[model samples]
Target: MRRLAASLATAVLAAVGAVAVVGQPAAAHGAEVFPGSRQYLCWEDAQTATGQLDPANPACADALAESGPNAYYNWFGNLDSNGAGRTEGYIPDGTICSGGDRGPYDFSAFNAPRTDWPTTHLTAGATYEFQHNNWAEHPGRFDVYVTKEGFDPTEPLGWADLELVGSVTDPPDTGGPGGDNYYYWDVTLPADRTGRHVVFTHWVRSDSTENFYSCSDVVFDGGDGEVTGIGDDAGTAEPPAACPDEAPGAPGDVTAHDVRATQAHVMWGVSQSGCVTGYDVLDAATGDVLAATDGSPMVDLTGLDPGSTYEVTVRSRNDHTGAVSDPTAPASFTTTTTTTTADNAAAAGACTATRTGASACS
Candidate 1:
């Protein structure tokens, strides 16, 4: 999920050659709690390790110790498949982060009542962009709640401890290939609340009984999205050394394929070390990252302006170590106007089928 920062110049759209643009047919997966979520913050900590699931933050390390690595691996999936709006008695206290025992994967350790967990800072009464990972995107409403004033993090969290603050249905998507994949919307925090609190999110899917949940730690300490407790030495005993980027070896045989008006294909040989976890394609003209891929040697570059000359380069990536290779020498390609025949237009307008045997579009 972690990659080098890219510019927001490309238009957002669904995956190419994949059916169902929204509400993906796959199982209802998890989301990111904008600012920060337990899983997300923990996932960020784990990426510092060169190999294995080594969390740089102490609390994150404790989470990994308590729950297995799968907690971070499946960070986007803290879901209960049949909650059906029964939250109070249905989900038990102290198990909010893991959604009780519903998971075939155990995330019970994430519910450990601790004040030292990673926290995102926010300004009260401020309208902020809230985002959630859209892994296998689903159509749903998000029920967001925050703990009451004077809520203690050391104590167990119960429904009584929270008050509903925000509710959004089918929020818009800030399309990108960042933070795994996510849904985005804006929400204003309560003006009267202050101090450390737990921001709970419940995603109710319209397609099925499957729902997702999260417990994001936050503080109203006048911070402008500056995170504490993980990277900084705020809670940990020993100050950890900054993680070094171990860039992968430069790729070979880089060539342009499938050049089109709005899209182009680029492929290259794998890194010699075979340690390359992914690839990032960057615009040579603008220096913005165009697209990224995990294992495929080829990537389809979209959102390009037609009749334009594009010089792009590819760089290998290692997600675990936060490392990226030097950009390959630029490969130039010119795109021509794409002609959309009646068949292509009709295909584009047709409702895409989903795994649940339903259409995602009207």
Candidate 2:
């Protein structure tokens, strides 16, 4: 029996609502941190000296404001420096900065909006994979930061909430003067970490100053036997269906033999199908449809003038879905020769005798 192939399908999930926080922040910390909380922070020096944080500013503020704290950033040109501090120390435009157009600084130049800080609902003990693909024209690399919500940018190492995992350089095949950059990090979710973790995909500029651009696409598979909703189903699309099953048909067994002087006998298996519409006999050499039958086997090749070889193949079609089966193996045969008697008339008319000559023909 022939096996048929089935179609392919995809499974999709639904989206969940934003998380809400209920408690107040401690006096030492500023605000209460909860799951799903999101915000932005910028280098203080860049904001003050470059006036980058003001929403009204055309270049710095506007560009920084549009980016989410969790978003990824891409620094322009080569601005290699060290450490994140005042903007002038990192940014090229900074007057106090010693590095050319770039300085070494920490979360000082630009940050996400304070109110719209991103909230992370990641659970501890679960593993997550962070992937980044940079198809940018120039060399681009980013750093991943998982910090606590509502952290101060001014304090040294204050933003180092939870280092789930980090990759500062571009992955292989993503670096160099050409080509895109790709990076990914796999980390086991912290058992102590829960509700509203701040996930940051920061672009590490040449200068120590870094900028945050986009948030990570969070996906929760399993952990602690607890099912916490995280991923969005509305955005997920189902995979397209697979190809339809092939139609069934009788195994094609065809045979051929020379007949008479210029004819040949061709025989093929009668097609049997639950949905067989028709069957076609094709000349294997020329691909021409020699004949079409509702569902019969066997055909005669006449008027061939003998001593000629021919090849034939057969195929069946499904009536319901219009699916056609592949052609069967070809069958080949040569026509037999014909002969007439001479005056001697002994056995001169025999096909073998005629070739032997008059004495044999006689």
Candidate 3:
């Protein structure tokens, strides 16, 4: 792969060190090229609130058929250890997305020749920041390539078909939660490039000989980061079947804690049904409102009297419509008595049962 030149700052290199994990193959760490790679976008399309792959897009559904469910689970890691920068000769022509290896096997199906794969729309000759996920941090260089104009998507992709657009070593780590550090660099799109093309990324690890490969389907129209073929619409891809409308189911595993002098904290599981948008908490003893929330699973009952017994009940709600669920069997808890400094000393002096059921005190 050719290392195309661009003036990247050394300060960007310093940011790479902060994220670098001491010992691990770049295997744990990989990229999701934006506009977006096949696996990355498909993985996003298939995911649900329950962490299930309920594919909403047709191309993603087809990919699920080819690669199976486990492939998307490891979406970022499309890599080959022995690549060593030999792009064309080492990796076979059509199997570029899978890195020409079956070691991380399920990805091979993504290399299937097809034109209907999910695509990201872009404006030609426009400058845009290329974003990649730093799953597990590593010291490597990103080599970006774009398919030449007049490249056909119906056929398999090959090295002869692509042109090296730009390369950057240690791109700045734009922060993201839970190690999804997005590395970004500004690259000007090819002025002559137009129509359907692939933005290929080659991540060459400086720490090891291993290299990662990705294929991002793209169309050079006049678009600006608006992804199609996703969401509730049946725009080229068929949307999943509609969920039936009913009252949201009750939340499970309700619990209470922090039974302090004046307040108690309560929480519960989110309802399994998609209809649940929020929850209504009630005082189980008096059937009065304790608290209600549209967001969090937890709520604190404040202004509660000390040494009082209080029970809180939770009900899942569907905010879209005015439907509330049957209340969960109430989680009953008693508030602890308010204590003074003298009470602490008196309690400490008294004997209490130990782990062995024997009495002990200081």
Q: Which candidate tops lDDT?
A: 3
State the C-alpha lDDT per candidate.
0.63, 0.33, 0.64
* Total backbone clashes of candidate 3, pairs 3 or more residues apart or in separate chains: 0
Clashes of 2: 52
Note each model's CA RMSD in angstroms.
12.6, 29.9, 15.4
Off by more than 4 A, model 1: 1-26, 176-180, 232-362
Candidate 2 vs candidate 3: the lDDT winner is: 3
Ranked candidates (lDDT, high to low): 3, 1, 2
Per-residue lDDT tens digits for candidate 3, residues 1-362, read: 11212222232222112122213342234655477788777766664443335667777888887776546655665787667777878888998878886444368878866766777788888888887877555667888899998898888888899899999998886663113457778888898888888889888888677788788888888877556665454243443343345567777667875455544556576566656656767767666655665533554444455686767788877655668888888888876688433223323432332222112121
Q: Which TM-score value belongs to model 2?
A: 0.27
Residue 263 local lDDT, model 3: 46
Give the alpha carbon lDDT tens digit for every residue of 1-362 in model 1: 21212111111111111221222222245555476778767765565222234566677888888776556655665777676756888898888777886864567888878887788887777777777877555577898898999898889888889999888998876553233456777777887778999998888887667778888998987766767776544443343343345557666657775455544556565455424556666776666666665533445444445677878788877766867888888998886676333113223443433222112222
The candidate that achieves the highest TM-score relative to the unseen native structure: 1
Which scores greater on lDDT, model 1 or model 2?
1
TM-scores for all predictions: 0.60, 0.27, 0.59
Candidate 3: 10-residue stretch with minimal lDDT = 13-22
Model 3 lDDT, residue 14, Cα: 21
lDDT of 1 at 348: 48
For candidate 1, which ten residues in a row score worst on lDDT? Answer: 8-17
